[model samples]
Target: MITINEAYVDSLALNAAAVKNGRDLVKKNKITKRCRTEDKTLLFGDCQGSGKEPYRCSVDYLKPESPVYRCTCPSRQFPCKHILGLLYASAAGQTFSVEAIPQEIAEKRDKADKREEKKKEAIGVGSDEAAVPKRKTNKAALAKKINAQLEGVELLDKLIRQLVQNGVAGIDSKVLKMMDDQAKQLGNFYVPGLQNELRELILLIKENKDSESLYTEAMDQLTYLHALLRKSRDYLTSRKQNPELAMDSESGLEESIGHAWQLSELRDYGRVQAHVELAQLAFRSNLYAARSEYVDEGLWMDLSSGSLYVTRHYRPVKAAKYMKEEDSVFDIVKASELFIYPGELNPRVRWDDGPLRSMQAEDLERIHSYSRSSFTEVIKLVKNQLKNPLSDKHPVVLLRYSEIVVGEDDSYGLLDAQGKQIVLQDTAYLAHATTHLLPLLTPELAANQAMLVLFEHELSSGRLIAQPLSLVTKREIIRFIY
Candidate 1:
């Protein structure tokens, strides 16, 4: 008879995430019929996934070193979570008595054995295998894309220069139509990212706000777009000369031109991290009128590495009613793998959903330990990143402070231990809702505490301002914005 333990079962799982999920199945009592054959060569059971119909799975260990795992699940992964869950049950000393193999499984094993025997006979037992051909990149296709993108960026540059020369005082209906038409043209050239930015400028004009504020918004949007275009065009030209020169690695310029990266590609570029633990510090849902989509943004902090990550779900405006929103999560999330996207500051992260438990005191301590205590240092970091026009203008962080103070003009600022002050203000797109919540907080909780803040740099005044999203006390977190 063979003996199975937790260590042995864990060692068998190549995908750590799958193993963790399998553990959850066991904890939920989803595994059933967990038993082994009298010969001790088989282990089998059933596990419920999303649907009520349980997936059937079995493991054949006639040759333990080369165990054969079978499952009815659609997953191509061997020893699917169902099988792992069954084995985990047994490893945890769950009851598994000697039993006969089911007739269906027995028949399947016989057929598999016959097929294996036929393959061995056809291959003539000890012959060396032929080397497989390595798949190569089609340089012609990639070069063509790079050329189209470069042309599109050049067109954008011409449009911006014209807008500057003519000025926006004449942004009437005729001018709006021309801008709209140009946005569509950019889309046709495969630079939809630029199209969205251009349409955003159009949307600002149509909002019919104060002229001065409109001019400021237009100037800022165009400046960022102009900088983004110049940087991406240079990157595309570099790829045009050397088609395989780490194209997507240049500050995610390729993605800016509408390249949707796959998880395998991110993993190949060493962007995926294993065993990531995150806490959702804040969340928000925003509508992008230009793109016709609603984006649900979740801000998460990595407790292990003290890193910030963001998760986004883009729902089309037409289908948004049918799609459920991913709202705030108060518990700590543990994920075996976190897929990292290309961006700066808070690069987007994604992970498979699973069961989560309520956070404990230890988790709170970890959050407090990772917070920034010095406003000066945090400002310096934000300034450095904001200097790059292409970088994220609004970056978020957790700030621990000695007290919250009111300025001479009734403005809010966070006071650190050394008396340095960081102003609190609203984000460009959001209202000052956090201000209303400030008065509601007790003085004891407001002093020597922490909060989740989104920092934005005022381009005209060069002042770094923050918007509080959530207030953290010793007991619980109060979120002003959802």
Candidate 2:
């Protein structure tokens, strides 16, 4: 059974209104109308704007269910809202008698329960043995995949450019066929995002829809892939190329924390960073903001000794004790491990707020660590920033009352500490979570920790590492005399 909160209900109602609006506009084009509703789920309808038949979809409201409405109305947007309204109506207090779970749903639930049980058992089984290695995708297989993707992307790019050059009327079934094939390839390869964009582009061209928006999005993707090609080549030859090749020309302290400075100007930024990136925290009962200049690209910090320096990614060491054997596959999830980039370059900050939101989850999991009180403190700081967003006085600066100990080689070290060295595992329970650290409670933090660490590949082992250099709180102080 799923519980619905009052706020969620209100949101659904609002969404339903939007869907209703969408339904009205879409129907104006004189397309066929269709409505659908699901038991314990959502409702939606659509009308054709093109010569084709109208598309309609709906999903039932079930626990942990995905988007209910699926449509082929040539819209890249999800749920197409006509469907959302019906679902919202159903959820916003309608009488639909409940019945026993369907056999298929019940069977799915049972299977899920069994899988969870196995995971738990593995966790408790202890480290008498390491689990089997996951299957690796071979290089030949990888090249073939990459090559296919390259072909699809190239074709899409060429199709759009050709459309822009020749005009919409010039488009023929052959061009449409090629675009459709590219879209299908992206979809088959699990790139629904690209697929959706391609669909939207096709519809826009066919209907003479918003030309400007389509052009902008298409260009954005084209530019991103172009840059990715260079980065991919650099990654392939990392051993031979200088480390600086991996870092973009945009690497610098000014660029790294520019967003942080912008945050200080806010009156109430809200947990934008939390919503945007990941952060590691230290537990602190006291409230304060901290600041420090970001020094260099791979400065290694001794978690035990409290020293900082540039270090490579693969400085082979044992896993943290808290790393359950079952969790070993996810190396980044290990708590309080420090790594640094040895080269002058900094890996670009990949933000979820935009396209190419994050790196591999396992990569992120490997660099994870928790603060005893830091997690709570960080969350509070973030929530405050999200809500307040601004202050008249200089933004708050937090300080570390203690040092963060790094777990390594059969031994432990205190990293980049300006205070007493303490073991984080002893102080706080590490969980798979993300956070942000900054000087302002009102302004959003620039970049949270995880990817900040993962972006910088470690040199020695050709693996990944995350290391913290320093902390400080920056504020523009003012004097008011009475």
Which lDDT tens digits does candidate 1 get at residues 305-334?
878888899888887644545677888887
Expressed as tens digits, the lDDT of each residue in 1-482 for candidate 2 is 23444343334332444546554544353323333334544333444444566555444444322233455555444545444433444445534344454454447557867996885464332333323222243656655544554454455556556666776556578887877776666654423334545665565456554656545544443444344333433433442333222222222222221112122111121111222222221211111111111111122212232222221111112321211111001011111212221112222221112111233443223323322224344334434532321110111112232333334532222223233331221111112122222222232222222211112122223322222223322221111100
Per-model C-alpha lDDT, please? 0.79, 0.34
Worst 10 residues of 2 by lDDT: 323-332
Model 2, CA-based lDDT: 0.34
Top candidate by lDDT:
1
Best by TM-score: 1
Q: Model 2: runs farther than 4 Å from truth?
A: 3-57, 65-75, 97-133, 141-235, 238-482
Query: What lDDT is reached at residue 370 by model 2?
Result: 21
